[model samples]
Target: MTKNTTINYREKIEHSHVYDVAKITPLEFQPNLSARINNRVLLKREDMQPVFSFKLRGAYNKMASLPTDTLKRGVIAASAGNHAQGVAMSAQKLGCRAVIVMPTTTPLIKINAVKARGAEVILFGDSYSDAYVKALELEKSEQLTFVHPYDDPDVIAGQGTIALEILNAHPEPIEAIFCCVGGGGLLAGIAAYVKAVRPEIKIIGVEAKDAEAMTESLKQGKRVMLDQVGLFADGAAVKQVGEHTFALSQQYVDEMIVVDNDAICAAIKDVFEDTRSILEPAGALATAGLKEYAKRNNLSGKTLVGIASGANMNFDRLRFIAERAEVGEKREAVLAVTIPEKPGAFKTFCRLLGDRNITEFNYRYSDPKEAHIFVGVAIADPNESANLVADLIAQGLPALDLTDNEVAKLHLRHLVGGHAPQAENEVVFRFEFPEKPGALMKFLDTMGHDWNISLFHYRNHGADFGRVLVGMQVPPNEQTEFAEFLQNLGYPHWDETHNPAYKLFLG
Candidate 1:
């Protein structure tokens, strides 16, 4: 029945009323990034859109194109992030009753934003896929029109308008256009217009390394579903590429690249440094791919365009971004070094570093024989971290690079050395300390050093609270006392004695 359902995506895009809620965002040249990569890197600022994302274009177009009868009955969509805002804003514009189903874990900011736009927010399961199933059920029971975030021709056409504006402003040829692919609607839409209008322009799709459903689908020549997707880039954390979007992308996209969270965080910093705007993890993914592509090909003096997709980041998440950005950009190297506990041991270690700026330093004077120091040093480039590690190892310092260790990055960074075998009845627990002065002192005083601190780690995240991992040694007979101690301590803690990473690294 629907051999021609795909229709002319390009024709629909050309006639789209995306400008109703969207705008022709600026295509700003990124001189700093361009100079660093030795390419004419430009950012298509879709982040400047009213809803702070290109999602509005598709959401508005889909709602606007609906028959008058359907519009009267209202629309429904499932999204935990940008798409929810898009539909809410679109619904407000069209004066329709919009229902947005979001995951239970969705941030309060997003939930409230949708509510502010007059959409009824229903918290469903823990992911977009779960919310999608619930939304489909509601569409039938409530008789609401399901407005898909990606997949649909109207949505794809709305997103495709980005390509039209990009080419219109810069009639000159672009070597490659990098885009982030979640459900594949944005990438598919842009690919349609670019492939049709400027067939020579390369359309490269980027995906989070941990969430590469679209990449896998493109490689296998069919749609592929991942059992699970990472939530770091929550906006692009789609488990499977849309069927229609995947089919269209296979024809239009030239290549695909997958980058890790570090690169995405680094790219976020890059955009912030250049445009003075911080983007969500998914928002900076396209630029991350662009930088990676330029480095891999060693291409210079070429024009590379990246869609800076959105800036709807929660302010608190910036702390995590800043922490990882250095490693992602290869600007900092984190290391765990065991130096002799003698008088000149620390001095000699500092001498070895020789003029390198110490970005961070956390040391615990535990053993009289040797001390362990968690250090982060400024680096010149991507390879410098490895080079520095090699230099330390060659110098007979038992050094281990903790740059890529998940446990080290999250917990161990502040944690003191592993389990103390000598201490009886050792217990390891993770805690969150209120981020105010004297909080640490309050704990120490409350615990009273009577228990003998076996391990402790804490780092400030520039927020209202700090995360800590602690290991305390207590005698078996003192178990009752320890329980009473914890209740009296009044600070929350989680036991991590059996964590695999702990056993591997510290046990």
Candidate 2:
């Protein structure tokens, strides 16, 4: 409950019982990333754990430390990710009953994995917080020991063993160690050990920008609860950092870095190139942070290490990750160019590109005077995108960069046909709906047939939510009524009515 000086994290970590169920994962050298970043890089391969996550270390240690009577009664946990498997596998290894409460919205693959490990699975609520509440109720009612995902002292100590392993395996100098923070358990544990044993080694925590609970918490000198967290890296999407973990992080963490989803995808690719292992978004967070940190500081020839936390990637999400990897690495530039609709226009554009590889080209003749084309070009340097745009403008082709535009990348790139000139008063909106049955029907039923549907685009990227881009014909007089409709919908929505991509393509 409090950061007591009496709690010896080093002693607890040194004597952790994790080896009974968790493996001592390899600290492997990354040749590709090392060569590319000009730094000696090593990856702590926690992804190679028995349950394919470092979570087993903490889970097993916590369970093994429990009293005999408590273990006999059983253990309960709430998680929709690696923690659930960690607890389940630990329970199986200990020959104790385990019950895991998971969100109903959790993927079937994960649910089945826990069940396969011989743990009773209870699908409850819509999110991890909701499931956690249910788990507490069940824990009290059934007299089950609650195995917290990260907040417990035993759990933090268990995770700290990773720091011991890294320091023992590589006795050489380590400039910094990067690890991802969700509820701050992983970073908290690692930082606590590193700071105590090797204070000179920097312990940096990485988080997704949209789900930066630890970053904000450390900034305000307290734990801050977020209203919502982006689920791209669902493993590290906790809205609030755990109390014990936050306390440890406050004392030991050196720096906090936030990265976007694109960088995470690129980090996945980086790991795959060196190790041929695919890491989930959260698993790749530390690598992404390491790359950013190295580039930002312009540090070369330093020994850097990152923890590859887990590899429980959903097969369906690969398509989306692969597509964003190029942009994240600054290897692809997306642009919208306006060229005269005449013969040899394409040739002239190609000439201007000057041997640069074209990744994608989407075009449809809309106007006799001009043509708007969506283009993706390969670039070796990040600065090349600006230079290429300048070249286009100098050659009389007006070019707009859409590489950073969410609307352009998610919707406009696919809807690059001729505009609907006849759809009067058309307004575009992007909506996120829960990826469940009848979600679309619910949206349509609430819409109430007041406006005409002019355009619609929906794509499933194997995420928890379904993203849809919609265009509707609403009269100016009813703008207030349309606004009220969106508010009542209860779904996250963004207005793209004036987005340049829509204006140039579908508007």
Candidate 3:
């Protein structure tokens, strides 16, 4: 945290035989992704480690560096999941007792895994910040050594070992290496070692769109605490980057990239298709960044590497990932269209489709002459939706692309109903707000608690932004005032009261 001093981490990385607890994972080239991107898309298979993550390298290195007396006193650390497993397994190997304090929100599978590694597990509070407090208390009470996840010099050096293996396995010059940043330990270590040895290659950090602690810190030249961070990628959901890691990242990293949850889900599917492996959301973050980076830079025939950081995925979460992956990849399209409500009208519209596949269709009669329908169609390519929209318009069928519309995707897509007949002076809207803890309270405070909410729907996708559909009862006389209020609200909102899809369903 103090002015960072120059460290010879490249020298340490050269000597680190992470093979003590970690393995020299394969650096495999993804043929399918490479062909698609027109680049040599290489995957650093850190997910193949015995612990299913890269955490063990740092954890073992730090613990192994501890003096004999400190090992006898044991060590304590706070972690939600992956780091806890790393510390526990490392302690076991060194014949040292490890105490892990974890948030109650951690998945049971991860908690059990840490316990299986012979660590005493303590489930404390709701988040990492809370559990961290408890770990500090225990460290003081038991006179134990505290393993700082990403802040310690030895820990960062251990993680730097990854860069050594990467360059060794990949002889070809790389355009860049993409890494995901949570507390920034992995990015910090990799950037340090890589920058020292290969100053020409770019060391880019990837962060979740909402959980961009390091990105903001680097922007402002100081650490910033996020009010809340998305939990979909639980392993990388740190509210703030470690001070040491931030300083290191600022010194060595070339640039940072932010990706959304949908892109991450799509990347998970991409890795599965390429290597028959399912990656956790955080694990696939680097892959998502690589794809976005390659497209943005328009670089072809160049080599790029993405670290598959971990595979600690829960089985039940697959359903949600699968459902959103299509939207993330733009392989599926959603639309709201107006069609005549008469016999043979639906048939006539179908004929204009020209063999495109339909994924979902929801329709209800809204008027005597015309009907509004919400439709989902599969596209052969990511950019095909715009062309299809043009095709539908050319056929005299009024259509609107709802694929990127937040309200349509989250609420209206799943809802189907007639008009709210008894509701008076109702104005319906869809809003996207930050997904942190107090986001809804701030929105309601901004809107004034005096208004009545007639309709509300929210589904959590573990992403940075929370999508909500709300119907507020407002008098016609206050229309102009409401518009002004909306303009100042600062959240991305759409007036859905006049939307044909809303008229057909839950108007």
* Tens digit per residue, CA lDDT, model 1, 422-478: 666667777766545577888888876588777777655433346688777777888
TM-score of each: 0.85, 0.96, 0.86
- What stretches of model 2 exceed 4 Å from their correct place? 1-6, 476-484
Q: Which ranking of candidates, highest TM-score first?
A: 2, 3, 1
List candidate 3 segments past 4 Å from native: 366-369, 418-421, 424-505
RMSD of each: 7.0, 1.7, 4.7
In model 2, where is the ten-residue run with the lowest total lDDT? 1-10
lDDT per residue as tens, model 3, 8-33? 67787776646678988999999988
Question: Which of the numbered candidates is closest to the native, going by highest TM-score?
Answer: 2
- For model 3 the local lDDT of residue 222 reads 90
Pairs that clash in candidate 1:
414-457
Residue 125's lDDT within candidate 3 is: 70
lDDT of 1: 0.85
The model with the greatest lDDT is: 2
Residue pairs with colliding backbones in model 3 are none
